[model samples]
Target: MGALGAGIAALGAGIGVGMIGSKATESIARQPEASGDIRTAMIITAALIEGAALFAIVVGLLSNG
Candidate 1:
């Protein structure tokens, strides 16, 4: 069960990252002049979402161990 939960969490994180990348690309394409700003915001958002997933994984490991 622990392994399964962790796997699901990882999948969710991957999906989130993918969505972020897709939107970021779309935004850059739509506004080339603001690509820099959009890319920075995208990276920060992705990092924050991934950080939560990482925290979940860490907590799972500690509990399972």
Candidate 2:
């Protein structure tokens, strides 16, 4: 069960990161002048999503331990 939970967390994180990358690329394409700002925001959002996923995986581990 813990392994399953961890896998789900990772899958969610990967999807979130992929979406962020795709959107960031589209935004940059549409507004090349603001690519710098878009990239910074994308990085921050991806980092936050990763942190939440990390917390969830940790909880799953502790629960099964």
TM-score of each: 0.89, 0.95
Alpha carbon RMSD to native, model 1: 1.1
**Model 2 ranges off by over 4 Å:** none
lDDT by residue (tens digit), candidate 1, 1-65: 66666777888999999999999999899999999999999999999989999888777666775
Provide the overall lDDT of each model, using Cα atoms, as 2-decimal numbers: 0.88, 0.95
Candidate 2 per-residue lDDT, tens place, 1-65, comes to 88789889999999999999999999999999999999999999999999999999998888887
Clashing pairs in 1: none
Q: After superposition, how far is residue 26 of candidate 2 from its true place, in Å?
A: 0.6
Q: What C-alpha RMSD separates each model from the true structure?
A: 1.1, 0.7
**lDDT computed for candidate 1:** 0.88
Backbone clash total for model 2 is 0
